[model samples]
Target: MTEGAVPLISARGISKSFAGVEVLRDVDLDLMRGEIHALLGENGAGKSTFAKILAGVHRPTRGSLALNGQPVEIADPRAAQKLGITLIHQEPISFPDLSVAENLVLGRAEDGWWSSVPWSEMTREARKYMDLLGVRIDVTKPMRGLSIADQQMVEIARALVSDSRLIIMDEPTAPLTPKEVETLFGIARRLRDEGRTIIFISHRLEEVRAICDRVTIFRDGNKISTETIDKVSDADIIRLMIGRPLKEYMHKLNTSIGEVALEVQGLTLPGVFNDISFSVRRGEIVGLGGLVGAGRTDVARAIFGVAPAESGTVKVHGKAV
Candidate 1:
C-alpha cells in the first residue's frame, strides 16, 4: 500500500466479550493516512463493535490501540475527538431543535464564551464543509426539519470542523438515493485527496468497489483478510463476509399473487404519514420499508391505530380496522 507504509492508527490484540460470550478475538485493524478502508461483515459480525472502540464508545475487554504508533487510552469519546478521530454514525446524528450552526459547534464551541458563536466564523466553517460535501441547505435552520440525507451531510461537516484525521462512516449511503450516493462518494474522494483517513463501513458491495481503496472483511468477529479493491470481486467479499458464496443477489421473484390480507387507503396522520395508500392480500406480507423517519412506522401506527389518526380509512378482512 503506497499510502499505508505507516498506518495512522493500528490496533492489535483486540478482544471483546458481552456477558461472557466472546464477540471479537484479538482482531487487528489498521488505517493509513489518505486511505478509505471498507469494513464488511454480516449481522452479529462485530463490525460495529470494533468501530465503536475506535470512536471511544466501547473499550475492548482486552486490546491495545496506538495512534500514530503511540499508545493512548481512549477513556471517552471526548478523548477520541482530542486525538483527531471521529465516527460518522450509520444513522443520522443531529440535535433536532438546534440550528445547523449550533449542532456543528455544540461540543467545542469557540474558546471564549464572550461571543463564543461568532456568526460569521461559524457560518464560514460550516459552509466550507457543506460546500465541500456539495450539499446546499440553510445553515441557520433547525435540524428537525432537514431530511436524513441532509442531516448526514451536516454530520460529516461536523467531523471536518473538528479537524478529524480518521472519519469512520458506518452505512453512509444506506438511506440515500442513487444520485445522493454519488454526491457522498464525491465527498469521500475529496476527503482522501485532502490526506484524511476514513474507515468506510457499508453493506453494499458495489459501493465498496466504487469508492474504497482497501477492503477488510470481518466474519464471526475476526479479521479475515485485507486487500486492495482491484484484487477482489463482489463474490469474493460476500464469501468472506457470509462464510458462504452468495449465489446471486437477484434470485428472488414472484409469478403468483395471493389473496388480500390487508387493505389501507386514506390513512392519515397530520404531522406524520398523511393519507398513505396501500394494499396487501391474504397470506401476504407487505414490507413497509424506507429510510428512518420516512414514515414507515408512522404508516403502520396509523393503520394499527396505535395512535389516533387525524383522518383516514383502513380495511382489514373486508372490514375497517
Candidate 2:
C-alpha cells in the first residue's frame, strides 16, 4: 500500500474463545488511515474481548488479521505494540505510588541500569505527551494523588509514547464529566489529524456521535455492521448492539407518589459520603452514580449498616425512630 493510502488495519474472520466459550466468531474489522471508529455493544456483547484480541491481550482461536493489508501475527501486547498497536484500557494501568514522569518514561529509561537517561529530557518527553492531549498535571505528583480524570490523562500519554498507530480505547469516557469527555475528544481529533487511527469502544451514544467517523456494532461476539457515522443514528447503533429494535432501550418515564422512605441526616461515613443528606420515600427511587470507586456502594451500605457508618443520623419519619 502507499503511504497512508490504505486502511491502517483490517481483520477477516477473526474468532476467539476463552476456556470453552466462544466470544468472537468470524468478526471483521477495518481501521482507516486517520479516523475514530466506535465499537458498540451491550454489557456482555464481547466488545472488550474483540478489542483485547486486537490489542494482543489475547490470541485469537482462528482467522486472520492484517496491518496495512499485510497479514501479521499478534500473540501478545508487546508484539502488538511492536507492530504499532496500543490499548488504553477502560481501567487505566498505573502505579499509584509512581510519579507521572516516572510512569511515562519507565519503558524507555529502563535499559538494564547501564544506560543513563537525562531526567530533564525524560520529563520533557512526558510533558509533550501530556501537552498533546491537553492534560495539565504535575510530573512529580504520584498517580494515586490525581483524580480519575487526571489519571486517565496520564494513560493517554502512555499510548502516545508507544508510537501507537492504532489506539484502542475501551470505555474511556465512562468516568469523565462532560467537560473532561470533551478534552478527550479534542485529543482524539488531534491524533486523527496527525494520521493516527483510533478504535473507540463506548456505551455512551453521545460520545460515539461526537468523536467517531465510522461506527461498528458487535453482538454476541460477531461484527454486525460497520458504517459511516453520518449514515447511522444512535438508535440504529443501539439496535444492532442488543439485537433489538427501539422498544427495548427507549422506555417512557413514569412516576408515582407515596410517603417518606429513606432519610439520612448529618450522614458521615469516613472517606466516603459525609455530611450527606438525601431522602427517598415510599414509591420513590434514588440514583447512585459516580466513578468506578467513588464510594457509591459504600454510602449505600453505610446507610443500611451492612457496612459500618463512621458517624451518621438516620430517621424513619419526621422523628429519629
All-Cα superposition RMSD per candidate: 2.9, 3.5
lDDT of 1 by residue, 179-265 (tens): 888988888899998999989998888899999999999989898988889999888888888777787543776656776667877
**Consecutive 10-residue window with the lowest summed lDDT within model 1:** 106-115
Task: For candidate 2, give the lDDT of residue 230.
Answer: 90
Quote the RMSD, in angstroms, for model 1.
Answer: 2.9
lDDT of 1: 0.83
Model 2: per-residue Cα lDDT over 1-103, one tens digit each: 1344667888888888889999889987777888899888887677888888888999999989999889999999888877888888767888899889888
Count clashing residue pairs per candidate.
6, 1
lDDT of each: 0.83, 0.82
